[model samples]
Target: MPLRSLLRTIPIEPSPEGEKGGLQRRMGTIPLMMLGIGATVGTGVFFVMHEAVPAAGPATVLAFLLAALAAGLSALCYAEMASAVPASGSTYTYAYATLGELAAVIVAACLLLEYGVSTAAVAVGWSGYLNLLLDNTVGVSFPAILSANPWDSTPGILNLPAVLLVLLCALLLIRGVSESAKVNTAMVVIKVAVLVLFGAVAFTGFQADNFADFAPFGAAGVTAAAGTIFFTFIGLDAVSTAGGEAKDPRRSLPRAILGALAVVTALYLFVAVAAIGSQPWQAFSDPEQQSVGLAVIIENITGAAWPGTLLALGAVISIFSVTLVVMYGQTRVLYSMGRDGLVPGFFARVNQRTGTPVNTTIVVAVAVGLLAAFVPLGGLWDLVSIGTLVAFIVVAVSVLVLRRKRPDLPRGFRVPFGPVIPVLSIITCLVVLSGLGLVTYAWFGAWVGAALLYYALWGRKSAARARARD
Candidate 1:
């Protein structure tokens, strides 16, 4: 293929709703907000502080703020592009429409880790929390063979709960957007209230001394901790994936993205403050505290078992929504690529009864379930972070390119201060990307290499065939 051909950009026309291969516009501002929250607030809130508190000390709250800022900047760019283009695929569609096919495919490659691997990882994590909740509430839990995979540290037959969780999410998704959004909204509400409950209970035991030695690691430590904390904001991009189905996307896309970010950031800070005040800062670094989480801190304060049980319930719900939204995002991205003939056409085929991409949802669910059931992806999380940062950079770059190339594009919301925010978004992402180890870069390189090879062997030819048929 000629370089010029690979550089060809997509036309601005988006398919109309309810048409073949097009999603229905049933997502209002509230459902979109719930989707964003559902994706963004996951098991991280339950466990991140144990790792972050050691580095930033009591100033881990500052690290949360810094991480949110990076996520916020990229989100602003996503809003602009989503409003301008109004499509299902997040960065892939934005990149194709602005930066061309080559850039779009590269973004698609990154998304495999961000959405695909992240979904499976969250599912596996959810399985552990499910057993924990069972053991807490009842006397018995699932046997080890059913709870873990053969390759895991403690080997087992398969991760049955993880696969079942993926199936339930897939069923909800296949039923249509309205049903999935409702379940996601309900899950988000439950998890949020659970955390709030923990905060309220933990505040009863607040100690003023915990804040005395704030920032024990100083500025460099805060910066390093921000890098560690940033990936918790990964689910924010899931909001942009629903652009094609958003009700009045020009207005709702920006609001939902910004709204979700605000809620997630405030929640993290609130929980961090409450957890730190409940016990000494140094206690968070203890190995036992890592697994017991905020629940343990509450248990220590209230001398009750119910709060820990409640938190375990929240942990299960937290990962469930994350898995659902991440899986949704992955399918929609593949839907866009499928429509463009970069992959199989069935991925883009919409079911008339449900008005959803049935084949795409099923295929994505099965793939994710298999990965969740047998593969251990917990150690490869840095790959998820790498992919997310790269995708955000692409989004920011797309905003810059579109502003220059299509200045008159009808964007519902624009990034404030012209190019400064978009440029800063790129620079901020690069700084976070720098924190990744060399091993991450090597893995990312190999991942991209495989994706490009697939494109070379079949993707371009497939697209050509589709265009000729049209």
Candidate 2:
């Protein structure tokens, strides 16, 4: 295929008129937003505070704000695109409609990392909390060799709990979306309640002195912490992935996207303030305190084991939901690509009885499960942040391109300030992207290069045939 043909754009349909193979519209705004919250709250709140606090001290609160600002801007762009496109591929579908096939392929690559690796990362975090829960409740824990990744700080043979969590989520996803959504909603409530409880209890030990040496490592540290914390906000885009399955895409897409972002940001801020106030920021760095940071704080405050056990139980339960939501997003995106012939058709084969992409879910399950079992959480999280930031930048830029190229297209939601919002969104994502080190960029580049190579060698031919058939 010629370069121009390969870059050809997919038509922007006003509705699902010509989209014959689309998923069923079964989700409403509440479930959609719950999916986002389920995806967003788990890993970051439970695991990342330890990493961020050590980087920025009490100024980690500022880091949460900075990360939220960046995520919010990108989410605004996402809301617009989700409402307009209303497809399963999320940014990939948006890019295909606006930017072109090549840009869409690139966005798909970024999403593969964002959703797949993040699922693995979340599972790894879940493993830690599961161990914490078991230790507190049963007076026993998984052997280090079975519970920790080989490359983690506490090296082990494999992370068995992480792998088990991924398999369990895959089973639930294969059962169907509505069932998954119901489970996710319940998990969201549990996690949010525990976070609020932590805040209330932590407030009892609040100390103004914790803020006295805020930003001890200065501006650089704050930026670095924001970069680290950015992964927590990654699941906000999961709302857009459900557009095809949304009961009313036009209303539900924007409402769910923005609503999820607002709820997550508020909860994150509350947790951050309460956490730093409850204990000195410097203590977050102690290797012994890193794995179950929030529970430790609760233990310190109440001088009892029960409160810490409650938080650990919540973490174990809620993080499982996070893994399920993220893995679902990953499979749905792959299903879109498969339908478009960018990947093998196996992914597009939905189970008729359940109306779910069973094959795709299984594929994602095996791939993410392996990563969770072997890869270190720190590296997986950094890669997720880089992939997500780049994907957000592309989505923001696509909004500008779509407005200029096809202004007549009906949009359910539009960014309030036109180019200004998207431009700022792009800039904010770039700033966060810059904080990542050279190694992360190299890994991201290698992944993208491999994806493009596959596109050139296989996807191009398959996509051409698929388009010709349509």
Candidate 3:
């Protein structure tokens, strides 16, 4: 037998109770779609436009399209895996069943940075907008000392709101506060409506000059900007992760994943196009316009505050919920790793009181909160792109491996073109990975190195390997 197959011989099966933990299967197709939108449409749509537009100029629309294409391909692969192996472990569990224990460990490590750090980044970004909303609408603002990060361009002592928000979400999750399918469907509707409103209002100020100097740095710039813009597309996998709770795993999972992808991509492209036409792309870099780029265009177009205020208010509400869902995903991924004995068992301990993993939630919440409080979102964005790039690459490869190893395994959703699709998916992910900056690679290396060292010295050696051997 192959060495990889030998590793699989060990039966480190999960305890049936923890396996069937009361985490209800209440998420259906509609709720799953909402979760995807909730997790995805937050900081990326509201905040990333300012950063991405200047890089790609009016071609920001094309950048959104390209990112969605790549994300769509990956999402299709994810749908197949999720339906084939319905579970809560996300990509880590999928990798374990199809690959081996070692590959699962590496994928889990990638996810730690992908989901955990992204949670910190989104929460921190949300804090900035929340502050903006308070100052403009409520006439209340926290001092710079408490509202900004100490390490920011204009340093503040701490970011109090960001920290508090993380804690709030943690408390909610511990009580098993899940968004019902109906509620999720409603949120998706609200999110779509708000973005459409922003696009319509912003389009009234459309100007032709913004297209001048399109692709300022040529294709390289578009690719680089896409790397940044890719964060907007991260939660497309929100479709796959809901497989266990989906109504018709085969039909609904694929349609929901593809439908959400199509809708989000169209909306994002519309926003990008509308924003570019509303102003000179260079104006995107103006600091005053960064927080509410679309809103600023509305203010300029209609010469009114109501539209801007409304957009900002929508952002504050929607982004808060996005932070909650994404942070919840991060905690659950860690919980799965902990349960597998690849990390501290403390992370897997479910609270008897609420029947949720309270301690783990707190640990993840505090760490992410501190990062959000002290580090600016700019510092966190590149790392999020890199971590996600690596994880997606792994999933793409896993799809191909599973096809060859277990051809008879039933897959509810299969990628078209067989090996060709998986191969293209892997290549596309790597191409995007290459576009990432040197600093992103450095940060990614440090994170992966840390996880591997922990695994080598502790997790791999002291993990359930010992239990399985005995």
Poorly placed runs, candidate 2 (over 4 Å): 14-21, 47-60, 148-158, 207-225, 279-291, 374-378
Write the residue-wise lDDT of candidate 3 on 1-470 in tens digits: 24643245222232222245534344556667677777778756877889988788777777887788778888888877766666556787777777777777777777777777777776776676777778888899777788789888778998888888788778777776353344445656786788898888787888888888788878877876787787677887755554444565656666677777877888888888888888888889999999666677778888888866677677766767677777767776777677667788788777655656687788888888888898766766677777677778777887887788778876678899877877787898888767678987887778778877777678865565645644
Clash totals for all models, in order?
A: 0, 0, 0
Cα error, residue 79 of model 1, in Å, equals 1.2
Off by over 4 Å in 3: 1-18, 47-59, 153-155, 180-187, 203-228, 242-252, 276-291, 351-355, 375-377, 465-470
Clash number for candidate 2: 0
Question: Which ranges of candidate 1 are over 4 A from the true structure?
Answer: 15-21
Question: Per TM-score, what order, best first?
Answer: 1, 2, 3
> lDDT per residue, candidate 1, 73-192, as tens digits?
998998888788888899999999988888888999999767888899889988988998899888788899998999987899999999999999999999999999999999999999
Residue pairs with clashing backbones, model 3: none
Best by lDDT: 1
**Which of 1 and 2 is ahead in TM-score?**
1
Per-residue lDDT for 420 in model 2? Answer: 95
User: Which numbered prediction scores highest in TM-score against the true structure?
Assistant: 1
How do the residues 1-470 of candidate 2 rate in per-residue lDDT, one tens digit apiece? 68886678877773553245557889999999998998888755766889999999999999999988878889999999988788788899888888888888988999998888778877887887888788878889889989988887778999999999998999999999999999999999988999899899999999999999988999989988988887778788888888778887877989999999999999988999999998888899988778666888888888887876887787787889888888888888999999888998888998878889999999999999998898766755678778788788888988899899889877889999879999999888777777779999898899999999999999988988888998
